[model samples]
Target: MTMKPYRSMLFVPGHKGAWADKGVNSGTDALILDLEDSVPPVEKVAARDVVAETIDRLTGQGVRPDLWVRVNPEETGLMNGDLEAVVRPGLAGLFLAKIYNETDVVRLDAVLSHIERLRGLDDGHVKLLACFETAEAMGSCEKIVAASGRMVSALGATGPNADAGRSLGIEFTLEGLETLYMRSRVNLALRQIGLIHPMAGVWQDLANLDGLRTFCEDSRRLGYRGLVAIHPSHVAVANEVYGPDPEEVATARRLIAVYNEAEAAGSSAVDFEGQHIDIAHVKTAQALVDLAEAIEAGS
Candidate 1:
């Protein structure tokens, strides 16, 4: 089944089952119950069951926000266990971490297919979201996203002081000039496959809502449709930043109207509120309007 793009994907420690509800209550568009870095090694096994149950608990007929789980990396010898435990009916997708290249996604796709069959799910029912953490993954992002039809979403995930920054040996900045090229490439990869709603990474400063907003704004300007949030407090900021404001949507509608009027009068383009409006501008405006409608329908 196809899913909507999540505006705010908030991470919750899988072992901390109680926090899942708290995260949902924070108004996140999706809940990523994690069994990866957030969970201690000793509790890794247990967290799988916790996340599975959490999915079962929160998911129901007509559930609004979807549930996604971030399983451990294949190298840890724990991904199989993680998938076996949580690939139940309620799971919307799997966030595959430490992805290196297209081969990794292909292998996981096969495994997920097998699990879906076992769980009585339709083939390709469970989608995959790629998390570009390592340098290899970042560089081969285009191939990875294009590798699998089940690859529903892909994120560049270049958070400061985190796996990406450490792996790429780039310093994080609020202006994001250091990873601008990397981000631009990833954004291009996303657009190459028509996955316009690409998501971006963690904002480490949990208490700094302003910083979070800045990071989200940077992503928005760079063409990201959503964000991967670490803390519940960041959910609102992510939603607000990535989502279209009323005025923006209204402007898009007006642009569409003006373009239609110009075309009816046999003009290919015209001045739209002092800005040139053409087919290209109408298309862009239509996209914003479409996104606004999708968000409204989902809400």
Candidate 2:
């Protein structure tokens, strides 16, 4: 699987085209043009057009970050119209909101296939980032993620008082201990299905930068490769937490060097920085170095 580095996916209101450029400049790895909750009921149709135009404009301007649109749920009659308007060139994928089951993914795959054929785009060119919001969706997380080859990542595991919280009736807390079970289950399912970089949902408290940092750090520790940032201030925090630390990169390089020397000397194991170094350790070190390099190159 080709992994895209999405350390920070910033949400931008589709109705506000001006915010698109601001989101791009905010240093987010990707921008999610939100047409579901952010756009008012009366402005949905206009927002789609605005989002499409902004996508075209961003691509024309040679923006580096991938652009994704968070379309309304499949149950909404507006999903088809939103897809039709935004499936043009420069759209990276769709952030499927409020997905309930594998059936939703299958239906979306079929729709995307039809759109690709009509638009002359390559098959499976438009990826999917499924949002598991409801209790039903979370229960079938594994099946939902495996349902579509176009699905690149999953989200909505921890959004408080939103789709997930409201669906589960869980209250919001900064500690996030309440949603640990759900988050861990979702993360394990994603990993089991080979979706290594599934996104942890947004941190709603905009005033708490420290809390956001702690959340990102905790998410990273739990094997989340990225996060959805509701504010630009959280972008840097996410990137910093998700990206490899300088000390870690240095240690990885040293580990690689020591392991290589040990291997060349006809030994399978060695001592490095008071830790037992072996093939498995070396492989982990190499992956860390590679990730660090990829982040650096992208930056």
Best by lDDT: 2
Which pairs of residues collide in model 1?
none
Model 1 has an lDDT value of 0.87
The lDDT of each candidate is 0.87, 0.88
TM-score per candidate, in order? 0.94, 0.97
Query: Model 2, residue 112: displacement in angstroms?
Result: 0.5
lDDT of 1 by residue, 99-218 (tens): 999999889999989988988999998888888888889889999989988877777747778888889988888888998888888889878787777788888888989888888898
**Model 2 spans with C-alpha error above 4 angstroms:** none
lDDT tens readout by residue for model 2, 45-114 = 9999999999999999989789999998868899999999999889999898888899989998999999
- TM-score between candidate 2 and the true structure: 0.97
Worst 10 residues of 1 by lDDT: 57-66
Clashing residue pair totals per candidate (backbone < 3 A):
0, 0
